[model samples]
Target: MTQENFNEGLLGFLDASPTPFHATQNMAGMFENAGFIKLYEEQRWELEPGKKYYLTRNDSSIIAFTYSGEKNYVMVGAHTDSPNLKVKPNPVIKEHGAVKFGVEPYGGLLLNTWFDRDFSLAGRVSYLDSNNIIKDALIDVKKPIAIIPSLAIHLDDKANQERSINAQSDILPILSTSDDFHFEQFLKDQLKISGVDEVKELYANDLNFYDVQNASFVGLNDDFIASARIDNLISCYVGILSICSIDESKPMLFIANDHEEVGSSSTSGAGGSFLENTLHRVFDDYEEFVQMIRSSIMISADNAHAIHPNYPSKHDANHAPHINKGSVIKINASQRYASNSKTVSRFMNIASSIGEPFQTFVTRSDMGCGSTIGPITATRLGIETLDIGVPTFAMHSIRELCGSKDAYSLYKIILSFNDS
Candidate 1:
């Protein structure tokens, strides 16, 4: 696909996926539309060569693969989850003539960016049906329903210099001014609007508030794209497009797991047995599974921090990645990123063969480094892996930015990698 078309599709995916559940559902739909058969974990598997299959765990993590009877496979890994504010179980709070919702920060997000923005709720909700059967449904309150307004500067004249956010008291999102507001009734209303009409008890929900603004092109020449959850969702989008557009006859797989933002320890996360268990199921022979893993390579795609012109000192001058330069190869001496000499050479060769420029990132020696699912997956599966990403700015902010050309560039490299 053309770069323009690819970016348009990416924008759509970003706007549609406000939570991990929604991202997984949207990606599963893409695979299904490309003739991939959906598999359930509870079902017995009947292996068939030259067919494609996709499966989900916890409705928030997804894995899609093509079976070609090959011992080795090409793999891509990404995370569907991003940093946001999660709603608590007993979220309702009435104070000072306004009804607000208690929220907890989901990850290491920029708390300041979340203030004074229009917000909406989206996630998975479980409830009993009319027949008393438990069922889960996805919900997206598309419109702006809440906001966390910053305290006026007049009240705290030192706000610009001395301001600090108290996560408990400073970030409660105002839902409504009316004291009669009922959180459960409001959720039921949203469920009905989302087509879940069976009137029954609400068992539970895993909801997160997201920026209501849609993804859009920015910059004087529209060279940049801006949106919430761009840190890893952009990588997920690139992986989806790359895997779907490649030759499916090859033994290739693309997996987008949930809970990566929170250390990836959940059952459906990279630290869990989801990917390993799935591989074992696909290759029943233990020896063959080992062989496959040993011979295969995985590219873990996550967003890397680009050198900010205003804060250039934050990055190492020699290892700073620039916007639109290319996909970044993230490296860390502490193994925070999984990139190694062998994997780096393999990735660089693919990009070079495709005539695409690539960059490398290394944090300053005095600074600590953040991580992705790369090292975790590599350690878990004992697979050769590399960490790479599109150079990004304002990562983990409510609205992040990235060059419009970077995602398509990574997509091209991944296509070449799959063929190699």
Candidate 2:
């Protein structure tokens, strides 16, 4: 596909996937449309060679694989969740006649970017229906309905120089100022609008506030993509595009797990047994499984921080990645990432084969580096892993930026590996 089409597809995926549940559902929908069958863990899996199948766990994490006879697997992994403010269970907090929702940060976030922006709720909500059966419904306000207004410059003289954001007091998103701002009733009304049937009462929810702005091409020549959650969603989309284009059915897989932001600790997270348990089920003989895993390779696809022009000193002089340069291979001696010399060379071969450019990233020795599912999955499953990403700017912000060309380049890089 053309670079323009690649970016458009990426935008469409980002728009549909504000929360992990939604991301998994949207991916499952794509798989179904591509003529792949769905498998449920509770049911018997009649997996066969040359058939494509996808499955999910916790409604937030998903794994899709083509079950061909190839014993050695090729895997691409990415996280579905992003950094955002999550609505608490008992989320209401009213003050000064203004109604607000209590929210907690889900992961490391650039809180300053969240201020003075339009926000809306998007997640799955559970409630009982007329049949008294529990039903889970996905909801997105789909508009700029809520906001966390920043304190005006007049109120804080040093605002431009320095600021401290209080998670408890400063981050509650203001919903409305009406005296009749009832949270439960408002949710009930939204359910009706969402075509949810027999809404008895709003029972429980796992909602998060996200920017209402749609992703778009930015920069002087429209070379950049400006949008929310571009950090890892770019990789998730690239993995999807790459795996689906593989013409031969093989022991290759794609997994988008949730809760990677805080840590991949949950049932659906990479630290959990999702990948291992799936492999166990797919293979019957223990000896074969271990041998196959030894031969397998995992490409951990997460967004890497590009060298910011204004903060060039923060990056290692020799290892800073450039925007639009190509797919970035992240390396750290401390194992925050999983890329080793062997796996790095494996990735380099694909880039060379496709004539795609690439760069490397290593943080300054004094600074700590962030991580991806690479190490965790590699340790858990005893498989070799490589950490790779499309370079990004303003990562963990409410809106981030990346080269539009870089996304498609990463896609072709992964495609080269699959085709090889």
Candidate 3:
């Protein structure tokens, strides 16, 4: 796909997916459209060579793969979850004449950017049906419903110089001013509007408030794309598109795991048994599974920190990556990232073969480095792994920025890697 089309698809994916559930749902749709047979973990599978299959866990994480007779596979990994504020179980709070939502921060987020933005809610909801059966449905309150208004600077003159955010009290989003607002009724109305009928009772919901602004191209020349959840979702989109566009007979797999931002310890996370269990299920024999894993490699695609012009000192001068340069290879001597000389050389060779420019990133010596699912996946499965991503700015913020050309560049390199 052309860079324009690739970025267009990325924008659509970002805007449609406000939460992990929605992201997984959209990815599943893409897989289905590409003729991938959906598999349920509970069902028996008949293995067929050169067939495409996919499955999901907890409706939040997804794994799609092409089944081939070859033992070795090319794999791409990304996370579906991003940092945001999630609604509490009992979210409704009426105080001082306005009803607000009780929200808690999820993952490491730029808390200040969340204030004074148009906000909406989207997530998975579970409820009892009219037939007395429990079912789950996804909901997206597309319009603006709530906002976290910042306190006026005039009221607190010190706000600009010194201000602290209290997660509990400072970030609650005002929903409505009327005392008649009921959270349960509001959910029921949304479900009905979403065409989910026969809702008997709302048992539970996992909802998050998101910025209502749509993802779009920024700058006069459209050199950048601005969107929420771009940190990892862009990688997820690249993986899915690359997998779908490749020759189906090629042995490849793509996984978008959930809960990476908050440490991937859950059942659907990279730290868990999801990928390993799936591989075992596919290979069946212990010997073949080990052989396949040993022969294969995984590319962990997460956003890399781009050097900010305002604070270039934050990055290592020699290893700093700039936006629009190309894809970045992230390395850490302490193994915070999984990239080693072997994997790094392999990736560099692939990019060079395709005539693609690439950059490297290493955190400053005085700064502590952050990590991705690369090390976790490498340790879990004993597979050769490398960490790479598009250089990004404002990572973990409500809205992040990345070069319009970077995503497509990485996508090309990933396709070439799989082909190699």
Candidate 4:
């Protein structure tokens, strides 16, 4: 596909998704549109050589695998969750005649970046109905939903670059006027549940503040994409596309896990039983299961840190990745990433066979680096894996930057591996 089509698809995913549930739903829709079948973990299965199967857990993680007896297994992994704010159970509070909701940071977030930005709330809400049965549902304000306005510029003139944001007090977003101080009642009404007193549980909620602005292609030549969740969503999207585009002559899988940022510890997280359970279900016996996992190679697809124009000194001088150059293979000597020699060579060979341009990323010797789902997944499943990503900047910020030409190239490389 051309860049235009890719951008349209990317932006559409970013816009429709505000929470993990929404992200998975959007992906499931895309898979369905491609005519892939959906499967639940508890469902009984019959072997169908070339049939496609997709599954999800708690709407937080998803895996789409295509099975056909083959020489080897090829898979790609990415995370669906991103860093944002979560509303607390006692989110309702009134101070100085103004009403605000209390929020806590969900993952590693750049607190200052959230200030003065228009935001929204979107996530799963569980409550009891009239029959007293617990029912879960998704709620989205679907507009410029929430805002964390900054203190007046004059109040802290150095705010542009100097002020520190207190996550508890500084980040509480305004909901309404003084008359709106009845936040508990408002929340109960908004969620369509009983009053705080009648309810067995009252959670202000774990809500994130989204940009509410849809992603778009913007550049003098339209060679740029500005959006949220590019850190892993890009990988998730491309992985699914690559798996769907290729013939399932081999066992091809796309595993998108959750909680990568806070460390994948949940049951469906990369650090948990999702991959293991799925693998066991795929094989008939123990020995074959071990063999299958050994023969498989997972390409951990997440965004790599790109060189910043303004701060060129932060990166390793000898190894810097640029936008549109192709995929960046990240190697950490500390084993924080799973890129060993064998896995690295295999990835390079795949990229070379397809003539896809690729690069290497090594953190500067003195600077600390971040981790991805690669090491955690490799360790948990006892499979060889490599770390790779499209180079990007402003990685954990409210908005992120990436190369326009990179997605298509990465897609090509992933397709080559699956086809091979």
Candidate 5:
């Protein structure tokens, strides 16, 4: 796809993926359209060289790979999940005659940012099928259905100075104030319209509320993209789309894990045995599996914080990365990030060869750091991994921002790495 097409496609992806389940499902559609063969974990072996395949776990984590018989496998790692407020099961809490739903912060969320914004509730819900087996359906209200309104300044004396959000009370989204309210019935209705006419018996649900605003170009020259979930979905789309856009001679992979924002300990996360088990199941032969892994290298792409103009001192000045500049090779001395000099140099070479500019970002020495799936994947697979991403701002806010061109650049870099 052309750069213009890439820009539009990325925005479309961001809009379609409100939650990790939706993100994985949307990506699966892309893979299917590109003729990628879907493999089942419970099914037997049918491996072939020069072929492309994809898989999903829990319908949230997904991996797509291609075989080209090359010595070194090029794998791109990313996350489908982002920081957001997730709904608790049976989460209703009626307070002062208002109906609100209970929610717990899903990750390292910036609480204040979500105080006042339209939210569209969306996620997966499990229901008993006609065959008595539980089936899952992704549901979205699409339009704004709820909101977390902030307290009035007149009511709280220190609202501007020291007000703190009470996750239990302050962050509960107002679902409705109608006399009759039933969340379970809402889920049942959602599942019925989710393309399954035979959805019966709402068994359970795993849902999250997201900002209703769609992604769009911002800035006078349209220099930036303002949207939610760009923190990692941008990386996820870049990797998945680039792989789909190219044909590799050697084995290459793209794995977007869920729960990365929450420490990745879930069954479908990088910290779990998903990657190791998949490699073993696919390669079967220990020698071949070892060979594939011995030379394999993974590049973990997640959005890096751009130097915030209001808090520029928080970043390392020398290594501050800006949006539209290029992908930033993120490093942390404490290993919060997984990038090492060797991996950095290799990525630098790849970027330089493709005329794709690259930058570096290091956390301020005095400040603690955040992490991505890079370290987890590197440690889990024992593969050389590097953490990188396009520079972004307001990373965990209700709405995030990034350069319009950076995503395209990241895609080009991933394609170059895949080709190499």
Candidate 6:
């Protein structure tokens, strides 16, 4: 595809995926488009070389790998998960004339951005059937279903820049005014669970409120891209595309894991056995693991903190990464980013070969550093690794910003790495 076409596809993917499930599903579709053969761990185990393969876990994480008898494995990693408010079980409740729902903050959410915005519901729901078999299902109530309206500016005089959000009281979204009791039934109705199943565990599941608005390229010159979940979804998309584009001579893997927002502790997260299990399953022997380790390399893809325009003092003056300047090499003195001199040089070589511009970022000496899956994955597998990402603003905010050119640049660099 042409460069313009590639960017358009990337923007479309970003707009469509607001949650981890959506991100995983979108990437899975792209793999199918690229002619990747789907593989299921439970179905069968067959050995083959020079074939494209993809797999998913808990409908939240995905791993796609390709091989062509090359000794070392080159892997790109990204997380599908993002921070948002999760709907509680038996969420809908009636109080006075208004209907509100209990919401648990899933991760570090910018609670205020959620105010006065149209939001929708999208996630999986599980239920039990006649034979007592558990059935898990996907649901998308695609319309503007709920909203957290802001109290009038008159009520809160300092509303513009100085406002405090109470996560419990201030953020309970308005479901309906007169339809209180029905609101509870509305959730049950959406899940298609019977009202009789009071003893049964009925929930909206991992239901999170998402901005109903679509992601878009904005700015007078159309340089800025705005979207929710851009922090990691952008990397996830690039990783998938890069792996699929290359005719691998080496074992190449793209692992888009879940639950990176809350420290990557879940079973499918970077801290868990998802990658370990897949690696073991692929190598199938102790000797192969040794061989794989000797030559393997990893590129951990996530969003990096770009120098914010409004808050220039927040970032280190000498180490700030700018938009459209190419991928940022993130390092931490605490070993949070897993970058070493040798691995950093290897990535530099890859960047040079592709003629892609690259830069480096380290937190100011006194500031605490943020961690990524790069360090964890590298430590667990003993793989040489480097941390890289598209420079972005609002790293964990509900909606984030990045330069369109930078995203395309990151994709090109990752494509080059995967091709290598």
lDDT tens string, model 1, 230-273?
Answer: 98999999888877887767888999999998999999999999
Against the hidden true structure, what lDDT does model 3 obtain?
A: 0.94
Model 3: per-residue Cα lDDT over 13-132, one tens digit each? 999999999999999999999999999988899979878999999999999999987877889999999999999999899999999999999999999999999999999899999899
Q: Lowest lDDT 10-mer window, candidate 6?
A: 194-203
Clashes by residue pair, model 4: 87-205, 87-206, 87-207, 89-204, 119-146
In angstroms, give how far residue 94 of model 6 lies from its true place.
1.5
Query: What does candidate 4's lDDT look like per residue over 211-312, in tens digits?
Result: 777777767877678887887788888987888787756678898998898999998789889988887887868988888889989999999988888999
Enumerate residue pairs that collide in model 2. Answer: none
- RMSD to the native, candidate 1? 0.8
Please give the CA lDDT of all the candidate structures.
0.93, 0.89, 0.94, 0.81, 0.88, 0.81
Residues 171-220 of candidate 5 have per-residue lDDT tens digits of: 88997877488877777777777887776588778899999888999999
* lDDT (Cα, tens digit) per residue for candidate 6, span 29-85: 989988788888677767478788888998899999885656578789999988888
Q: Give stretches of model 4 more than 4 Å off.
A: 158-161, 181-206
Provide backbone clash counts, one per model. Answer: 0, 0, 0, 5, 2, 0
Give each prediction's root-mean-square deviation over alpha carbons.
0.8, 1.1, 0.8, 2.9, 1.3, 2.9
149: Cα error in model 3, Å: 0.8
TM-score of each: 0.99, 0.98, 0.99, 0.93, 0.97, 0.93
Decide which is better by lDDT, 3 or 5.
3
Candidate 5 segments whose C-alpha is farther than 4 A from its true place:
none
